[model samples]
Target chain A: MLGAATTPAEARAAFRGGAVRPTAGIAAGYVQCNLLSLPAADAFDFLLFAQRNPKPCPIIEVLEAGQLESEVMPGGDIRRDVPAYRVFRDGELVDEVADVSEVWRDDLVSFLIGCSFTFESALLDAGVPVAHIDQGRNVPMYRTNVPTRPAGRFSGPLVVSMRPMPAAQVADAVRITSRYPSVHGAPVHVGDPAAIGIEDISRPDFGEAVEIAEGEIPVFWGCGVTPQAAVMASKPEFAVSHAPGHMLITDLKDSDFQVP
Target chain B: MLGAATTPAEARAAFRGGAVRPTAGIAAGYVQCNLLSLPAADAFDFLLFAQRNPKPCPIIEVLEAGQLESEVMPGGDIRRDVPAYRVFRDGELVDEVADVSEVWRDDLVSFLIGCSFTFESALLDAGVPVAHIDQGRNVPMYRTNVPTRPAGRFSGPLVVSMRPMPAAQVADAVRITSRYPSVHGAPVHVGDPAAIGIEDISRPDFGEAVEIAEGEIPVFWGCGVTPQAAVMASKPEFAVSHAPGHMLITDLKDSDFQVP
Candidate 1:
């Protein structure tokens, strides 16, 4: 197993070599992105969907058809960069593969979207404690009643990640995260669970729940899972996405997403 | 003539009533946009181009194929919303009409992009003196060597608008405009005009030139005319855009585009 001390290149090589199993916190200070791959016929709509919902789908880079390697991240192979990929047929998960080389097609278009991990670093830097990092658990995520802007056949409710922060540091959290719009910008909602239709904050739709201390407010941010929910709702004939928590590490620095 | 006192609804109503004139400073506080209408076949490429060059082309709303009215701005007819429309055929200027009702087709896709007027309000609010607004001249613009990120069938050098500001106020000007990313955002280049390929700032490629006073720097922001230049360069089968300064006044407020 590759440890957290490995360089991004070494980490990617390990993943390609079937040594790294999941990329939760392997390479620090680098960007880890969610992947969405679809056919050319659905590319325009998916692109438009991301454009309309930038908060949930902040695009880091888009790979045009027939291009496997990202121009921004040279030597990174789209087919083998990540630890795992999930193949979906009509929105149903059919297979989980270590490599997607055989299923790769000329018509495939890829999108790299910003992940919440970018802002989690900012939170930690600002002295705000992250519950999941301390407990070695997944960050809580939930499907909300918030409706995303419909584009073509893609239309669904928004998905959000939850983090319990002390009320005193909520403002600082907002300020720091707002600087990184390319990653899920600022908090969509703070202090309330019923408002966004998340009936149970302790029980999440995805990821393990973490402890919320007294005087801490539960904050919500647009999640990368949003596009996946949209894809599942749309029921496209074919699609591929990185398995949850198995992100493709990019060459981009966390500061690249910051606004001046 | 629609005056600054006129309401947005009244101005749009007047525009639809054959009031074929420029829409500059007509509806105060409302967002105005540059229009780009293209065949559905070319919609994907144009959308991608706008996505890549957001500073020059901040897409406010995109009316999909067969849609006549924008969902964001209700009851507004795109076919006759703007005061004037310039039609291009095979990349050449073919006609300038008051309305595109006769030429409108079902396969057409319309994109409404942010205009500088949205950010000019921000500059004025910040007490930055706008020379063109005071002297009653159109903001000077020029084509520069700064190349835009090209998408399918679209590629060209960037176009920028120049505003002369006292050296001391340049920072304030940048700080204010950076808030409105939907409206050309911040300055792409500040200082020496020749460095960005503008040999003479006095002689602009579009709009009347304004005099640069002593201790002033020529600050340049990406211009909305970039898409028009790219469309002309790409030589598409057919395209339609708003004539200079004749923009589509949207229901969105200038304050709405502000970051915080």
Candidate 2:
């Protein structure tokens, strides 16, 4: 079970010991979160950014200044729980570190955001095919013409992750994903890419592109990459985030957010 | 259609001309919102408070500093739209005004929160009898032992509005109200009010108490009065809010939030 842990605590312990990697497919039934930590000065604006654009930046938990253990995740440590972390200084990637203890500061506040993996799992369980996963590639993502509502100094175009499914199952897919509002909720756009101002479907701004078969339509959901895009555009002096593909798995089950 | 106008624009016009009163049951189908305004300096903490305790402070729209018109409500003016406004200074009620224009400044941030009347109306429409309405009294409310997750300088106990409903109809009532998450959503506590620190079912901390029938149970939902409670507890230098029972009618329909 070295690469396959069943609980978030076990996963975090492995991560803390420097014996873990990308968290997808691990902790299969648990919730995995995208991490974003910023200085207290910018925390308000970043939180406001998330509030204004909840679709792309659905907040799972926000830690108070200097606090590391998550309110929602028991025994979760922000500094050492994640397998990999990326540091940003003035909007540029400065370092990739396994643990941020040396760079951690008392003024830093952390935010745990919802990851799309939760909904993707639900989609797969409902018999909907995910093209990128079927091809063993990263999900296709694109920068859209749709602008996010601005908050303080944080504002940028929305970034979305796309999955292609047959036109007949689009309604079912929407219904399934809508149950997980905390995990990016329903699709923002479900049809043609050009309608949202994407020039080409083959080349994505980030992630690998996938094939869309005949009678299939491109479905887009708000991606967690949005906050990072906003951070890059705003150019804050310092920030910390989980490395791409490396997530912090929490103790809560994926089905916990299925509201009545 | 003097009193039966179904548009927010007409309602606001009437409010501005000193012709309108409490907004409940005025624009029958449109959404009505609770208003809160604070200086720019305190806006961050208040917004964080609302974000942390979403059940009680489900924000419908947030206006940027010095901005008057709501992003969600087209052509709505914050200063003159609400029939009655309450000004609080140092956490004490200081003035009740029709127009806040004289006191409005360039550093004020306004927020529109969902009102419970939206869900109450839905419950009534679904054939679930509301005890307070049936008895022509205000819904009872209580200060619970449950404390809201604190954010920034804001922290306080949870305040809940109570309604007594027959046990047989509780499930249907919950289902009907769960559709509107932005407007105080589903009940926080159902049955055995004492479990959540209510000692007396016959008395309430706020509003009028209604009789709980022999087969009925006391159900509680997070109340919008929560944010105001936080404001009072934190003792901010200045704040503005809609007078109790007086709300801002928005153009959006109540059914717009009915999700899958």
Candidate 3:
């Protein structure tokens, strides 16, 4: 098991040396970010899209044209820093690669977005059970009826990830997670799935469904996959993103994101 | 005096009808935002700059290439909504106009940025004296030695606005304004002006300087003018911004921005 004691530099070094695996539990105390790289032309629209839908796409760092290393995560290379990257052309996934140095371009703008993983750490610390981790499964995600405010060429519905917990623990879960607004803060909906247009909680649109014990309720938070969904819908000419669960570990601690 | 009872729509109508004045007291309860417009090409860079340096340039709303109305202040027109605009070309101020309708272009992108005026109201409400308002002078502004993170072509020294208040009230002033992060939040520096590179407490780079009483400390917050200074330094081919004290009024109340 990759323990919480690992530093962000260690995790990135592992990813750089052909370690392709989920980043969960590695560098546990630090922030793990979602990656989105696009050509300069489409960069503005995507940045605007994230600005309009901040909950799902809380921006941690943006590496602009001609820049490869992040200011927030110094010494990390954007091209080959992550363990895995998904390449898409005209919105279709074309390749999943371990290294993207060959495809890196001077005009490519990279965005490091906050992931829900940071807040999940806070939840676990506060004694709120995360069902998927206990069952060794991916957290359930759903495309909701809620529409994100459109920006330029991007327009799509809000996407959310769910975790089931005891009804009594819901308030505590909300209070804990709300402190990290950059990492998909607080539950968007608490009790009913159908209210947000998820007809059946048993089948999720992405990731595996987890069991909800008796006296427990399902809670949803804005998911990081949301911006990817919007990118896919818009079908941009070219784009790159970190594969699900394979995030870029940053030097920043999870505590750095907490509201003071 | 324009009272809190006035709506965004009503205030906009007054601006549209050639009411050229400071927007401070006009929209008593609503948010009044700083305006900056540029070509769509420069829009991404400016937005990225704001994202990197959020404290000084908190984006209240951004209108993309084709859009003219803001989502936050619905039904308001971007071209002529604000009472005044300062047109710039290659870093030099060229014109000051009451309406930008004729100058508006299809490719122009508009940004509505949070102004410190919103939080000044909060400070006053908490019984913390705002020296400039009480004495009927412009809030003192200075360009600090601190540099803002560069985004694309936008980069410059951090600019801050100052207000003098009793040393005992500094904590309460911070507590009240910290709730509104969308505006410049809390004091960037307190007690020592020279620490941030302000040579003379009695002189300011922009706006009128007010007296700092013996018992009061000069508190500084990130100023909204920082973005404009950045724009000027970058020498973007073309740009439009509201004259310093003039602002675009939004429907969102000052309390709407409070995090808790």
Candidate 4:
């Protein structure tokens, strides 16, 4: 198991060796990014979509067509670095694999987006408790009735992850998280599941749910899963993405994204 | 004669009527943008270029291929709303016109980039003196030896505008302007001009040079003109850009882009 002292290169090496696992706590202070690779034809559309909806799809870096290495993650082969990769065809899940070097195409343009792990660390650091980490479970996420500003063929409903906290600490969470706009900054909604189209607090559309303790209100934030949801709903001809919780560990420090 | 009471729509209306004038100080407190329109084939390349060099080319909004109306500035036509437009063919200035409606192409994609005018207003509001405004001359801009991160067919030297301020207020200017990253946020260099490769401070490559009074130092911030310079150097088949100092006034207020 990799811990706080693990470097990003070491983490990538471990993943390249077939370690299929979530990459949340590994290389603690460094940034982890959600990956989405698409054909050159669909690259512009996805880029526009992400640009129009920056809250949920904050782009860290975009690798040009046929480019494999990233400026932020130098000497890294994107095809085999992430622990897991999800292959999608016409928007349907075709296969899940540990490496995609054989299937990778020359015209594929990969985009690395900011993940919630960076901001989640800031929350925990600020004395604001995260329910999922405390309960040893995946974060609860929901799809809302809100429609994102669509670009080209990419369009979908807004997705959010919820963290239940004491009503008193909700503002602190908002203040701390808002400092990092690159990683789904600030909460979208603070209370009432129905307000954002969630039917039940106990059941989530994705990930495991934790109890909202007495006197705690549910705080909703824009989720990184939004781009993946768009891929499923819009059904692009081909796409490659990291499995949930499996991310490309980048060299940028968390403080590198913090705003004064 | 537009001033503090002017609305963006009215300012644009004046331009649409063949007022070929610079847009500085026209729509006070509202966001003004540098416009760059390119053929759809080159859109991705320039987008990548701007993404890589955000300090010089901070994008505010991107209009899809052949689309003109902006989300931030509704009821405004891209071709007719700007005070002046520059037509470029194979990297050469072919014409300067008041309206581009006749030459507009169905496949052209327009990019609205953040302008320093937004932050310049913030500096004034914060009690920092602007020498160019007081002298009634343009902010002096220079092309430096600093190379921007190249992307596709777009690449050029970083361009910066100089604003000389009292040494005591330099920190205040930096603190106030850094809040607006969308408008070329933060100074790229502080004191010595020779450190950044500028040979003579009085002779600027672009814009009129202003005198740096005693006890004042020239501070440099990334200029929005860098993208236009790239367009000139790369020699693409076709391109359209706003005339320098002639900008598109948008509906977004200056404070709309202010960070906490």
Best by TM-score: 4
Clashing pairs in 2: none
User: Model 2 off-target regions past 4 Å?
Assistant: A1-4
DockQ category of candidate 4: medium
DockQ of 2: 0.58
User: What TM-score does the first chain of candidate 1 have?
Assistant: 0.96
Best by DockQ: 3
Where is model 4 chain A poorest over a 10-residue stretch in terms of lDDT?
Answer: A65-74
- Candidate 3 chain B weakest lDDT stretch, 10 residues: B1-10
Off by over 4 Å in 1: A1-5
C-alpha RMSD (angstroms) for model 2: 2.1
Off by over 4 Å in 3: B1-3
* lDDT tens readout by residue for model 4, B1-260: 77768899998888888888888878688999999999989988898898889889999999998687877889888989998999999999999999999999999999999999999888988899999998999989999999999988998889999999999999999999889988998999998999889999999988899989999989999999998889888988899999989999999988989887
Model 3 lDDT per residue over A1-260, tens place: 35588888877877888889988888878999999999999899889999988889899999887787865667878888799998988888899999998887788899899999999888998899999999999889999999988887887889999998898899999999888888988778898999999999999998888988999989999988887888888888888999988899999889988875
Clashing pairs in 3: none
lDDT by candidate, in order shown:
0.88, 0.86, 0.88, 0.91
Cα error of candidate 4 at position A88, Å: 0.8
lDDT of the structure predicted as candidate 3 = 0.88
Give one digit per residue, the lDDT tens place, for model 2 in B1-260: 53546677888877877754676668787888889999888887888889888899998888878688865667868888899999999888899999898998788888889889888888998899999889988778888999998887888889999998899999998898888888999899999988989999788887788988899988899998887788888888989999877888888788887776
- Candidate 3 lDDT over B1-260, as tens digits, reads 34567778888877888888877677687899998999998999899999988899999889887787866768878877788999989888999999988877889998889999899888888899999999899889999999998988899989999999899999998888887888988778888888999999899999999988889988999999998899788999889999989889988888888775
**Alpha carbon lDDT of residue B195, candidate 4?**
89
